[model samples]
Target: MHAAAATAFDATPIGSREAWGWRGRTLSRPVATASGEGWLRLVSAPADKACGKLWEGPQEAERLMPPAVPRPRLRKRLTWTEDEHGYLAELYDEVTAPTVTTHEPILREAPDLNDAWWEGLSTALDAIATVSSDRVAVRQEYLDRAMPQYLGIPIDTTVPAWTTAHGDLHWANLTSPSLSVLDWEGWGVAPAGYDAALLYSYSLLVPDTAAEIRRQLGHILDTPAGRFAELVVITELLQTTTRGDNLGLERALRARLAYLTEG
Candidate 1:
């Protein structure tokens, strides 16, 4: 199965042509761009569905950033009516660091991430986690619903503390040499340790990588609350494994689950 690239947009929105050039394709509908002076992104969604700020949730959450953390700064947003979905567009200052998600599908080769980069990512996550918000990360909800269908296993309904999370925290969404997590559309209040769990889940294919994530974020993943969040992440990964998404990590995820649940 061929993965679709965001670069193959059926049409570029009206305002985009005048302001920015396509920087690159992301894994989804939103395309990043170079706006001569700064960077921006083009987000599109169905028209009937009420189009507002492109990547509305992410943009709103970006507003909560503290002085230290690095994130794309949104300058302007424009929406235009279209035949199918409306064009939801936003322009932001470009990120200075290189993205870790350069490879088409999943990252085939790991980038040269160092201690500073990982430390920066951890610090940014810590900052985001301290924030308070009413926004809900809908993608996590959908994934929660799908977990039962995928795992066919009973879930511990014990609720955990919630806080602001980046929603999507894969390597592709993060930069190297410097730390700058990208794609905030999914950021919102989530279960404790949610971000760490998701990152660890994605890293299960690489034992050393997975271990490093656990080592750095162990404070979050070691708590009972963190363990529950990890279970949620495990369920999601197991689903992807069944679909043949991350084949290399299939055995590792199952083994991790066994270790996690054997208690």
Candidate 2:
């Protein structure tokens, strides 16, 4: 992939594109001569598959980033073709968007994230539930199969209801300092507690903080409805295993197992 990236960089019209992030195999290059610049990126097969292709033919890239906030615009997508039907795939002349951070995300964090953060998040979850319900079912099955044995508890059968979800929500994908979310590639309808579950699962790395946050946000998952939150944790566990990202999978699995067997 490095050789292919080098070759693609050499052949393309852009110059001096640097790489970013672990996944995405993303590259950034200046598109104009001015101080403010445009950028381009290339997505390989694995990322393409992860994002899901709605159409057939050679894998195409979707313009994943939303244009500057407040405006909520979408940039045009750039497509590439395989060279010699093998090895490298390429995209050319892709325009980059401005990197300005909106003040809303920064200001919104403090008050919304205090003790009230969870409540706001729960409200967002409810708003999302009005949009979709797919992840609810997928997550339930994952828990039933993968979590029970490890946790020694039967999977909770009740659905926690539904919502729209970012599908992938984490700190890394979020812009730094301000916390504006990026990479909406997997946005979709989901169960009501989906985002809450994801945030909780990842928060396991800091058990005390996770506990505090969950406690503050307890209303979001109270009672039978909250089982969907557990479903979210198990789903993330299965996702980690499936993607070979075991860093937190074991701990998450153990925690989940404990949760199941405790009562």
Candidate 3:
């Protein structure tokens, strides 16, 4: 993949520094492009699973998202085949600011997020929700089944409102000092307040940060749609805990579920 990225982008990958996604499905490295410095990301999938929303999300986001949203800009894309595997290489404008975390979605420590950063996030989220997309990030069927099975809430599973969302808004996908959101491969339609709810859920490990998020997004998080979105996120994380993912957040998540249900 490194060789392919270098050849396709006509750039030299630097050093041993590399970023990898879950199960090594994606790899990102800094490169020296002819225009300037850039980040190269490579995604791989079985040939059968290579054509779908996930495969085309970045390009779609590049086309649809406005400049007001602070995100990495996709520069170019290339695709290739090797055996049963399909590989995609995407080069993006370099973002110098580091991610809020080295890895992991849960925030263990508080980041010095300023008012501007918080305001930018709120504004960007508002902008994102207004866009229309057929891609479904959190399906109603999954919410219907997961909420009852995980949250023990047998109430109507229909989402109160549906809106376009970043779909996977977490600490690792965010940057500080300048506030650039990353990883647009999953942006799509979801329950209203889904992004805020997801960010609030991940911030739970740090109470102050979580409280700040709640405060910044109170207009959304405090509404019925927002509450339902929170429950949906909680349900998903609880289900993942059974798979040994995010075990540290299990207790906090359950407590949150109890609070939400009790309220």
Predicted candidate 3 versus true structure: per-residue lDDT over 107-199, tens digit per residue:
999999899999999999999999888988999889877888998767788899999999999999999999999999999999999999999
Off by over 4 Å in 3: none
Model 2, runs deviating above 4 Å = 1-25, 28-41, 46-73, 83-127, 132-152, 156-158, 242-244
Lowest-sum lDDT 10-residue window in model 3: 1-10
Candidate that would win on lDDT: 3
Residue 147, model 2, lDDT: 51
Q: What is the C-alpha RMSD of each candidate to the true structure, in Å?
A: 6.4, 7.7, 0.9
Better of 2 and 3 by lDDT: 3
Candidate 1 residue lDDT tens string, 48-94 = 76433225765676678775567777666555665775555555565
RMSD of 3: 0.9
* Cand. 1 TM to true fold: 0.77
Model 2 per-residue lDDT at 257? 48
Model 1: weakest 10-residue lDDT segment is 1-10
**Per-model CA lDDT versus the true structure:** 0.64, 0.45, 0.92
lDDT of 2 by residue, 1-263 (tens): 43445343443324655645345444434444233333334454433342332221112112321222211122334344454221223333333433222311111122224444344444544554454233223355655666555444465655556555666555443443232344444555555566666666656655665676578657665555556566655655655666666454566556664664574
Tell me how candidate 1 scores on lDDT: 0.64
